[model samples]
Target: MAVDDFNRADSNDLGVNWTESDYSTPNSLRILNNRLRMGEANGIAHYNGTFADDQYVEATVTGMQFGDGQTGIAVRVSGSQGGFSAYAAILWPVSGRVRLYKYVSAWIVADAQVELANVPYTLLTDGVLQFSTVKIAAIGATIKVYIDSVEVISVSDNSIASGNPGLIARSSYWVELDDWTGQSLSYDITADAVTNGSITPAGVTSVVGGGSQMYAITPDSGYGIFDVLIDSVSVGAVSSYNFTNVAEAHTISATFGPLMGQRALLKIRPENCGHITINDNSPQYWFQHGDNIVIEPVPDAVYALKLYVSDFPDAALTTGEPDSLPDEFHSCIVDFACYALSMKLKKWKQAAKYYNIYVKNLTQRRKDYIDRKAEKRAIHQIPNNIKYGGTRQ
Candidate 1:
């Protein structure tokens, strides 16, 4: 067995991409099942050969950001080859948050959520984390996952719809996970939220109350909407909105003008009440604790530009005069915000007769913000990859 199987000597981060060998870093050497004589990792360890079919791969990686770069072992993964759709090994530093992402066709989120043990800072004897394990169970359209010898999830959607499989890794960076088990698949519901009476993984809400209940489905793809009836009565009928029933991560926005008279597009989302630094970027509206942000690539809109918060949480969640710092005392507002959105989006009927789920719990202030933000842009159209101090590394 090749001790330097990853071929550390030829790995470097050219900013554009990493070499082929570095693409196959591992989370642990035990993945070899004592088959290979593995040693310390220099970070980059990729499968430098051609592609294959139905392969099981695993690895243990160390010294990587909580959510950056493919720091784990990869098997029969596919990328630029087809827009990065593989099971990356991510070990949350200091907390050992071991996880495997089946980045299917959607490059943003993993096929399903896999929670390993919390990674600790001590694993880095010298920026090298202790051996971790990542495994895969691929079965056509559906992909199952396992970590540390434990099965996690059996996704219902394609992990990465259509593409060849191979290893993946960022340039220069270092992360390793080993367990060269074939590959995995996940027939997961892409990040797109589908709540037209269906409880999907997007920001959801469920409210139940007296009389009849109403709901406003703010999808990641839509503007043309209609009034919703629970039993049968008039509740919230403002605009005839149009939305594409696909998959994607969505926010709370009001689409009023897409129908008839005075059509206006209004949006309401959370912003950080602190500095714009990395430290303050937590509690991002898009993702909740423990893999709540189940994002997906939704279909494009017709005759309209699909509005979305691209650099959100990263850019949207910021603190200023209106934003307040996070505290147990003031945490109720945050919970309220999440609950309000979820309930509104959920199949909940938690209001008096004839109340739209979108309007529940929202005070006058929330309404005002939604009204004002109607003209804001929600995408990151950066020309070229711009690099700052702490970019997407």
Candidate 2:
């Protein structure tokens, strides 16, 4: 029930719906001795309907009069007569190679050939009447080619999902095709995701045995893929996955988690001239640089400094921009500037007040960060109280 025969009374009466296109000349296809003969042109003869996802198309090359060209079976043919696309499993008798090619937009584009095999099959011996059976099987994203019932090439691609089946011949050649047939099978696909992310085509999809489907995972803001699981086995942190030649149902899931301790720029301005310290440690300080002030942490000072502290050594009363601090704590920059200005003016009482405010705001900022992290962990079902050293409780 899976095979369809192509040999009938004539080319038009081949018992299956079919259409042909001559890339070089018109009326290049004819029926001779109950076989489809392609005459001196590069073109394709496409079946006028779609095939199952998991299917195979095969034909026997009965006569190839020229050794310079190639002929083969075309599968998953899509588009119009002038510009169509399909995967071709071809035999080049001159080169003694069996190759898989993708025909697109009225041209046989180069380098798109998926190599299959190389064998001397006497396809162009002129009067020798040698023949070879070429078969192409599409199982999900996997494409496999067989010559004379022996597996030749197998490759994975999700490009052409399902399309019509056909025959193709290239350039100044006479090739005879007979005993063309096609068959189909069945399969299933499924998708899922863990917290903070979603998967496209988010449910089960039914397809033929050789068909393919592409799935993409999108993580929410501040989240990234932790891992991807296919049938309970890890496949690393990939955002996209393609299922091919699925013979049975499958479950694909992606897990996402918050990206830990993301940092942003924080600009700090010092108010007076004095040696400055951050979290009780001195930082690299600069006086002036093109109408701007720059202060950088000493090497390895980032780990020693407090998460919310943004102090730098005193240099000029102008603004100083520090790099790589969390964005949420940016408001504390003004408080620190005021505290430094108060200290420079020798206003001890005012300096103490602003410093206290800066400490309070910094503490609140840290608390907010921790609270947000705890909420994210709850949403992702991760344990919130897992102990850690330093400022990350």
Candidate 3:
């Protein structure tokens, strides 16, 4: 069994081995709506069991208010009466970001943070409630994070490898959790490459059933895929393999041999600029497409002659271009630029048409992006049949 759902009225009963932290206040944490809800006090509800090193823990939290509050999941927790420690992946509504923290001595320590999309997330009420699905996957020293089914962060840390699993919340927030699940995988999968080749999804071993594990074989320069093996059995020399609905443990290995003869290397000269200038008023030195470059600066006689320039590449307009605007709406760049140009030329009708096109494109792109993200979430559903054990049970 790989999943657990707290959907019963007595879900909080100790008989199920669900225990609150010694620091949590009585009645501050309870089961409601078949989900765990936390009240005003900062608290942690721990499942009293020891899980393996490679495991995944996740929960869906809702009814979170936007203030100095956070709610999330804790894994690999270890400590005693005076001090307890664990790694927490939290949804911080106030900051509009998801953060990973290492908690020790009752203090939360920041590890990593990523900003959330500005789109209006699914909300039950008008600006009063927001929900998020937070998941943490730990395999050996590598830790991967996912929010609402989107993979956000992947880090490596081996400080705390194995311990108990639980939930965490800060003060003055009412947070509800559902589909809280933890699984202890049975088998370990590993991979090794010889002669300048690499494999991915290699380090991960505790994948649950119905989960798809993709293995990508990448060879270094001057090498080609020679052979691929699964559990020492030949699986041909394919560049990639997908193990869908993985239900058993297996070992994968790839080997790379030399490419035919010697391959010529190609190189290109760097771009050269005629001159450079320094502008303190500008937020950044790198200019993007259509960005206005200002030449005027307040005169300071002593520093006027000094010039400092940095080599910055011009931003490109492409499918994979990185920009402040969402990637899906990158196609509207032309419409937006045309709208601005029309306004400058005092062409009211042309400006309005371009503006409307830009708005419509942006709105439709946002909807499409949201829909694609929703599909990604459905692909990684948490496994079922998780068990929590304690002395009371």
Candidate 1 Cα deviation (angstroms), residue 23 = 12
TM-score of each: 0.28, 0.44, 0.44
Give each model's clash number. Answer: 93, 11, 4
What stretches of model 1 exceed 4 Å from their correct place?
Answer: 1-4, 7-10, 13-53, 62-70, 79-82, 100-131, 159-165, 169-174, 177-393
- The per-model lDDT (C-alpha) reads 0.33, 0.59, 0.55
Question: How well does candidate 1 match the true structure in TM-score terms?
Answer: 0.28
Locate the minimum summed-lDDT window of 10 residues in model 2.
378-387
Name the TM-score of candidate 3: 0.44
Residue 214's lDDT in candidate 2: 86
lDDT of 2: 0.59
Residue pairs in steric clash, candidate 3? 2-384, 3-384, 3-385, 3-386
Off by over 4 Å in 2: 1-16, 108-131, 186-207, 210-393
Instruction: Write the residue-wise lDDT of candidate 3 on 112-176 in tens digits.
Output: 22322222223334555444677876666666678777777777776676766777766665556
User: Highest TM-score: which candidate?
Assistant: 2
* True-structure Cα RMSD, model 2: 16.5
Alpha-carbon lDDT of model 3: 0.55
Worst window of 10 by summed lDDT in candidate 1: 382-391
Candidate 3 displacement at residue 365 in angstroms = 81
